[model samples]
Structure formats: structure tokens, C-alpha cells
Target: MTKAEETRTRIIQQAADLFNQQGYAGASMSDIMAATGLKKGGIYNHFASKDELAIAAFDFALEQVQKRYVRAVKGKRGSIARLKAIIYTFATAPDEVTVKGGCPLLNTAVESDDAHPVLRERAQRGMYQWRRMVHKVVQSGIDSGELQPTVNPDTVATILIATLEGSLMLTQLYGDRIHLQRAEQHLEQYVDSLQHVDNLKQQESSSR
Candidate 1:
């Protein structure tokens, strides 16, 4: 890539981490400038304004998180497996793979609620995509008869997202991974509970 393109990318990456760690109001232009090691003018040349940069950084952070989810479910067959893989991804993501502060969706949602219209919209879109992903997986399970036909994919998606994101907040608040671990365990059981009776029996028989 050209120098300009590379520089812009670098700025976004740095700003993403900064904004993720510090909320929109908390993250100042000087902070971003310091993080990117660029002067105010240099940064302004790339981004029209702080709001613009914040949006771009948030997008970048959300993309990294989405990519993690995608990679986590790769090669995992069946809805239960895929969903568990997603939970596992959130539980085990390393510092490099994860946004520096925490879940971007959770952070942005809390920080931007009714405060920043653009960012609130972006977070809402990101959350919708995430929910859709989970909904699709749950629906697939129901279609394949691995999950009970009566199960509601929308409900499952809501539960999964709520449980995971809430647990994530607790994890970050306490600086302990145990909260996430507990969430993983609970979600595994919850996912298992969604399994169709025949699917459970098949597993039981295979184990014998």
C-alpha cells in the first residue's frame, strides 16, 4: 500500500484501541494524536473531524470483533457447535485479536446511547448483525433437527447475546476471566438443552 494509505490504516488501528478503552467523550483529540504519534493537522488531513475519526475507529474495531466470530465458527458443523464456538471465541480471545479495552459492541452501546447519534446508529447496526448471525445459526439447527423445532431462534439469539455480553461486562469490571468462564459453561448447558431429543439419544448411543 502507499504511504498515505498505510498511515491512515495505522491511525485507525490506534484510534480504535483508544476509543475502545476510552469512551467517545473520554477520548480526546489529543489522546488520539498521541496514540497515533501524529500531530493534530496530520490527523485532520486524513479524517475530517473527531466524530468522523471516531466512527471510522469504531468500524475498524467492530470489524476485528466480527472477524473473530467468523473464524471461531469456521469448520464447526451443526448449530450447537457453531454457537459454542462463538462463545468460546469471546471467552478466549487474546489481547491482540480482541479490541484492547473490551467488547466494542458493549462499550459503544453503553457510551453512545442517546448521546452520539452516529455512533449509536453504528452500534445498533453492529448489534443487529451479531444477533442475525446467532439467529441464523439457531434456525439452522432447528432446520436440521439438531435443535428442537419448537425453539425460537430469536429468543435464543437474545439470550445468547445478553448472557455473553453481560458476563463480559462483569469480567471487565472485576478484571477476572472467571465471569466469562462461567458464562461459557452456562451457555454450553443452554445450547445443549436446545438439542432435540433424538439428537441427544444419538449422542448417548454413540457414546455406548
Candidate 2:
């Protein structure tokens, strides 16, 4: 990457973490300056205004989350396994990626819902993408004869996403890991239960 591009990326990364840790209104120019170690002019040279920077930072955070989820499911052939992997990944995201802030989508969605149109739309898109991924896995399982044919992918995906996001919010608010762990366990069970009886039996026997 060019020097300017590299600088811009650095600013975005730092600002993303700051915004995720502190709401859009809470984070100030000084916070960005401290996080990026950039003067006001340097930061503005990359972003036209604070609003623009915040939008870019939020997008960056969302992209990081998407990439982590993708990596978690990589090389998993079975839809159940892939979906469970995603649940676990989200349930216990690494501190580096989480950046002491937890899920960026949830943070941004709740904080920006009423005030920031661009950020709210970005969070909405992130949620849609998540639902789509879950739906794809459920539909693929049905097509492969691995899951129950009667399962509704839309309903399953919606419930799974809602439950998981709600779990994250509770976990963050209460500073307890049990909520997250319980969500992960329940999600894993939900995914496993979606499998056909024969598949479940085979998996059970194989575990012996």
C-alpha cells in the first residue's frame, strides 16, 4: 500500500477501536488524536470531518467482525459444525478483535440508532449479513439431507441472531461470562438438533 493509504488505514483501525470502546458522542477529537497519534490536520486530511471518520471507523469494526466469523467457519464441511463454530467464535471473541468493547455491531446499533443515520444503516447491514449467513447454512443443510426438511431457515436464523446478540449485550452489561457461555451452548444444541435423526445417531456413535 502507498504511504498515504497506510496512514489512512492506521487511523481507521485506531479510531475503530476507540469508537467501539466509547460511543460516537463520547469519543472526541482528543481521543482520536491520542489513539492514532495524529494531529488534527493529519486526521482531517484522511477524513473530511469527525462524522465521516466515525462512519469509516464503524465500517472498519464491522469488517473485522465479519472476517473473524468467516475464519471461524473455514474448512468446516457440515452446516451444523459451521454454525456452531460461528456461535462459539462470537461467544468468546478474542480480546484483540473485541478491543475491550465487545461486539461492534451491537455497540454501534444501540448507540447510533437514534442519532447517526449512516452508522445505524451500517449496523443494520451488518445484522442482515449475519442473518443471511445463518440462513445459507440452514438451507444448505436441508438441501444436503443433513437437517430436517421441515425446518424454517428464516425463523432459525432470526432466533439464533437475536438470541446471540441479546446474550452479548447481557454479558457486556453484567460483566459475566456465563450469559455468553449459555448462549453458545444453547446455540450449539439448536444447531445439532436441526440435523436428521440418522446424522445425529451417526455423530453420537462416532463420539464413542
- Candidate 1's residue-wise lDDT over 18-100, tens digit each? 99999888999889988999999999989999999999999999999999889889999999999999989887864445678
Q: Which candidate leads in lDDT?
A: 1
- Give the root-mean-square deviation of each candidate in angstroms: 1.1, 1.7
Question: Which stretch of 10 consecutive residues in model 2 shows the poorest summed lDDT?
Answer: 91-100
Please report, in order, the local distance difference test score of every candidate based on alpha carbons: 0.92, 0.88
Q: What would the TM-scores of all predictions be?
A: 0.97, 0.93
Q: Alpha-carbon error at 25 in model 2, in Å?
A: 1.4
Tens-digit per-residue lDDT, 36-106, candidate 2 = 99999999999999999999988888888889888889999988889888888888783445455888888
**Candidate 2 wrong stretches, greater than 4 Å:** 94-99, 204-208
The positional error of residue 108 in candidate 2, measured at the CA in angstroms, is 0.8
Clashes of 2: 0
- lDDT agreement of model 2 with the native: 0.88
